[model samples]
Target: MKIGLYFGSFNPIHIGHLVIANHLAEYSDLDQIWFVVTPHNPFKKKNSLLDNYQRLEMVYLATKDYAKLKPSDIEFNLPQPNYTVNTLAYLQDKHPDHEFALIMGEDNLKSFHKWKNYQVILENHHIYVYPRITKNIEASQFDGHEKIHAIDAPIMELSSTFIRKAIKARKNVEPMLPKNVWEYLDEMNFYR
Candidate 1:
């Protein structure tokens, strides 16, 4: 099976996330898209993030109906400040029969080299990149551009960071998240 690992801190799962996962599963060779819930992202600030378990559960609720979409808690037991290369290597070792690939935005592609053990990841896995605001960096920026693939999907201008900020400000972000996810966040008092 071909699995595409979509890593994120899904503070609360949103429509943009579902759209991208659905698009990749429908249009690409991927058999499934797993939302790898990272405990903490090295590049991100901890103060802005919700609890990893909360975020993971929200992803579970949001993706319940899709067979091709899965919420992975594989990183829960991994070390904090999760690194993509380590996760990829761990998954490969654990699931030898399945082929795993990465699904990220063009923004991540631009900084792939700076990621921990990036060369190892590039050598072993295929990377699928969707268009993002930072995509204008051009392919020449990296020697491993060939390992990265661009997908044809509608670009979503939403990010979990932005959504969390909106919630903190009591701004209207009902449209930014899935209905039940918002309810769950409220029920759990996440991000408060």
Candidate 2:
């Protein structure tokens, strides 16, 4: 099976995340899209993030209905400030029978070179890039890279940061989040 690992903090899982996962699962060669909830992203601020378990739970609630989409807490047990290469190596070692690929957006691609052992990741695994609203990365940038695949997934303008801010301001975020996730947020009073 070909699995696409969609890594993110998922502070609160939003519609944008679901749309991309569903698009990749339906349109790409990937058999499944796993939302690998990172405990802490090296490139992001840890203070602003929700608890790792809370974020993971939101991911579970948001994606439970999708057959091809699954929430993963694989990084929770790993070292803090997890690196993609390490997670990939670990997954490869644990699930040798399944071929794993990466699913990211054009924005992430713009900063791909900054990631730890990015070259190793590019050399060993396929990278599926979805279009991002503000990013303008062209296929020509990765013209010589056969493993880099550009997908025509829809661009979602909504972002987790925006949702978080809206929630903090006591604004309605029901439309941006999945029903279960929103209910969970309401129950927990998250980000308020």
Candidate 3:
């Protein structure tokens, strides 16, 4: 099966996330998209993060209804300061039958070179990139354009950072996340 790995901290899995994943599954060759929840991203600030398990649960709640979208706890079992290369290697080893692909936004595309062992990742895996607000990937520049593909994923203009700020402001987050996720966040006083 062709599996697209949508890796993220998912501080809170919002509608924008679901919208993109759903759009990918509907319009692309991917059979499913796994939401790989990172307990801690090496490149991101960990001090502001919620508990890993709590973040995982929010992901679970956000994606529960979509059979094509699954919440993965792969990083929860791996060592700290999570690295994409390491996680990719580990998943590749464990799921040899399944062809894994990287699903990321164009913003990440610009910094792909700086990622740990990015050359290996580019050489080994296929990347399914999509456009973000400020970044648009030019596929022709990459050495492996055939491997690095882009898709037309609808934008919600909503971000985890934006949503977190909204929650902190005690503003309505209804438009930001799915109904269940919004309800859960309010109930748990998440980001409050």
lDDT scores in order: 0.85, 0.90, 0.87
Clashing pairs in 3: none
Using TM-score, give the best candidate's number: 2
Measured against the true structure, the TM-scores of the candidates, in listed sequence, are 0.92, 0.95, 0.94
Tens digit of per-residue lDDT, candidate 3, span 1-192: 998999988888888899899988889999999999888877877888889888888889988899999999998988888789999999999999988899998888878888899888988999998887774545535635778987888866778998899889988888878888888888899898
lDDT-wise, the better of 2 and 3 is 2
Ranking by TM-score: 2, 3, 1
Per residue, candidate 2 scores C-alpha lDDT tens digits across 66-153 of 8999999999999876799999999999999999999988888877888899899988999998887774545545655899998999
- Candidate structures ordered by lDDT, highest first: 2, 3, 1
Clashing pairs for predicted structure model 1, backbone only: none
Which 10 successive residues of model 2 have the least lDDT summed? 135-144
For candidate 1, the lDDT comes to: 0.85
Stretches > 4 Å off in candidate 1: 140-144
> Between candidates 1 and 2, which one is better according to TM-score?
2
Residue 171: error of model 2 in Å? 1.2
How well is each residue in 1-192 modelled by candidate 1, as lDDT tens digits?
999999988876799999999999999999999999888887777777678788888999899989999999999998876688888888989999999999988777777778888889888889888877653466636535787778988898888778877878888887878888988988876665
